[model samples]
Target: MRKGKWGKALGVLGGSWGAPPELCPALTAVFQSLVYHECHFTNGTERVRYVLRYIYNRQQYVMFDSDVGEYVGFTPYGERNAKRWNSNPGWMEYKRTAVDRFCRCWYKTFTPFLTERRVPPSVSISLVPSSSQPGPGRLLCSVLDFYPAPIQVRWFQGQQELSEHVVATEVVPNGDWSYQLLVLLETPPGAGSPTAARWSTPRGPPEMPPDAARSKMLTGIGGFVLGSLFLALGLGFYLRKKVRGGAGGRVPPGPERLPRQPGLSGLLGVTTHANTNVVDGRKAFIILSHGFK
Candidate 1:
């Protein structure tokens, strides 16, 4: 059996020539037996194949290919059985020789097709505000788009490497053969204290200042709030003016005149005894005519 570049099984080959009747029964027995042998081969990003089955009892060992990686191993009982059977020095040496021969053959067959595998990661660092249970802030270090899986991430405060208040997530696959890891440092509130995040896959280290980060966040929020408030007030004033102008038209060419009552005219801009009496009489005459009509 051969697997395609994507690790999927391409095809299967089987032959049953010159096999004895006892061999068939033994193969069937091996299928039900717990003892087995398994082998796997892969070319990193592309193809993979697996062969697994009971070693004896009338069955030829099964072989298959798949798009996904496969893991096969004997159970504890099978392991104990093998150990007991191979306890003799001759059997042990023979088993080692067989395994070595198989490995040599597999290497010779597949090593030429394996591609070069090295991919660097993209690293980013951020300061996230967190609650004060552990600290007042958190420094997040993200390593993304890396390959080969094994990576180390570290946190530092000044020249000293920090272990306390540090949390790291497992290496997560990105489903495209790349991986990512997130590390967080719980930083204490301080003034201009610098924290650094370091990673093995990515070379350079990035630094973050606690005070600067917090101040920047606050500045952004304050600017947004102040801008919104000014906008609201401007909109409100414009709407109010629009409604008043639509209803009342332009101001009549002077200071607005008030009704003349029994109050004295000490109020500034208040004309206590102007020609409003004539104006009021005309307005009353117009209202009375309208009412009568």
Candidate 2:
């Protein structure tokens, strides 16, 4: 490989114009290799997205061909690249190795020209201090429910784990089966509210104003009452309709009649004292119309 000339050519053609000539050869090799890998990809945008998914955060990278000058380097997969990249039992291990190799290669070969930007892996813990009065309250946290089973929960006051004052309650499973662990901390002296004053000791609770505490309890009760009222109203309406002989709604046509049971008719009065034995046609029609009701 022609080092000096190749480096300059690769730097310019590979889109690494800022890189010095000495570093060109290494950058060129990486660029060319990436290009070869990307050749199998049909969509250029997809290739770029795939590279970005693995990289997490990316810096400027140029591509070089052994014969051609420079072009953009990218992965063959799209933004949803990881989904396309098949994973198996050993896939995760392979990915870790690849990341280490890439980091080492970029650091050694590119040096000052190819700056290695470190993006720290992040884990966010939303600290919700139970009612700033250093007392019994629930600390709720949101987390992904599926895939990785058996999550870990820990409580720390500043640096040390809170042993005496804290207890992890039952891990409640949500409707979706995701788990949430509530940490209950008993109130201690000098415990201040989360929003109020800061505590002198790391473990002590913050004192919340009495009014604030009262208001929180009242709000919870109010919500419960409202919910109960709606439930009761729904249930009462259902029962009322059922009890009123199941006939309280819009009236059915007057002609509608109940079918007589086979044996039940004999138990009822079969009264008949027929005084109008002589039936005129007009009188019979009039009686028939009245009976329809």
Candidate 3:
């Protein structure tokens, strides 16, 4: 069971996800008791939770508790609240008396009925692509399924801690009896630089190197280009060979031969007329059939 401030977004809790029907009246009473306060409540078989926050003009006070009515956590206004509360003896005395009385009463009535249990967490880490950087990328460390809230997570490089380019989400309840948190780390562009995530819980030891990932991507592209070049060369060679073979096998026509006459042959001092044809780098000739004149 748990409760927290939802501000103006309280309307979101009006449907099935809202507080249990049995606890609405008690929560409404707590809200109306103060001029300006927001209240949320959750009740389960094992535990009951309540969170009350008071806001007047600008002053604020946040208080939370589980099972028992005694405040497990409390914060009043800000640094100014400490100074102002201490300045007045009567107000300081009243505040102390009220807290002691509330603790004593709640513990006596409810502590005996509380249960003892522990829930272990589930953690997952992954690398996600980021548009903020052209290469390299971002890492997401997700911690989930833990019981009793509040866990610590940190980023590291070898033994050195990484403080910059990191973003963390607040602890959020998982509807079930667990909580979750998300921590993001931005990897700087570099070759073979390793990044690690360390968590207080016993679940994480995830490491990723930006250089190795980049190298793999480049290797795949290089293989594709080399293969394409070989394929193109093979196709061109086959086409050239086919054309040469066709040219070498073709036959050229023989040149026309003129008829020989007996009188003409004597005048020309020739016994035969010849015509030549060239094919496949060899020459041939046709000789006229005529006797010497």
Top TM-score hit: 1
What are the per-model numbers of colliding residue pairs?
11, 19, 1
Model 1, 50-127: lDDT tens per residue? 333444334333321122222222555445554564466675455445434654466567655432244556666665
Error of 1 at 217 (Å): 34
230 Cα displacement, candidate 2 (Å): 67
lDDT of each: 0.47, 0.35, 0.47
The runs of at least 3 residues in candidate 3 whose Cα sits more than 4 Å from the true structure, single-residue gaps closed, are 1-116, 188-190, 201-293
lDDT of 3 by residue, 164-255 (tens): 88899999998877899898877642333344555553223322233333455566666666666666666676667678874332222222
lDDT of 2 by residue, 172-282 (tens): 656653444444445331222121111111212333323344456666666666666666666677678879877544322222222322321222111111112222221
User: Using alpha carbons, what is the TM-score of model 2?
Assistant: 0.18
Lowest summed lDDT window (length 10), candidate 2: 284-293
RMSD of 1: 28.6
Per-prediction TM-score: 0.35, 0.18, 0.32
Off by over 4 Å in 2: 1-147, 175-177, 188-293
Please give the range of 10 consecutive residues that has the lowest summed lDDT in model 3.
Answer: 283-292
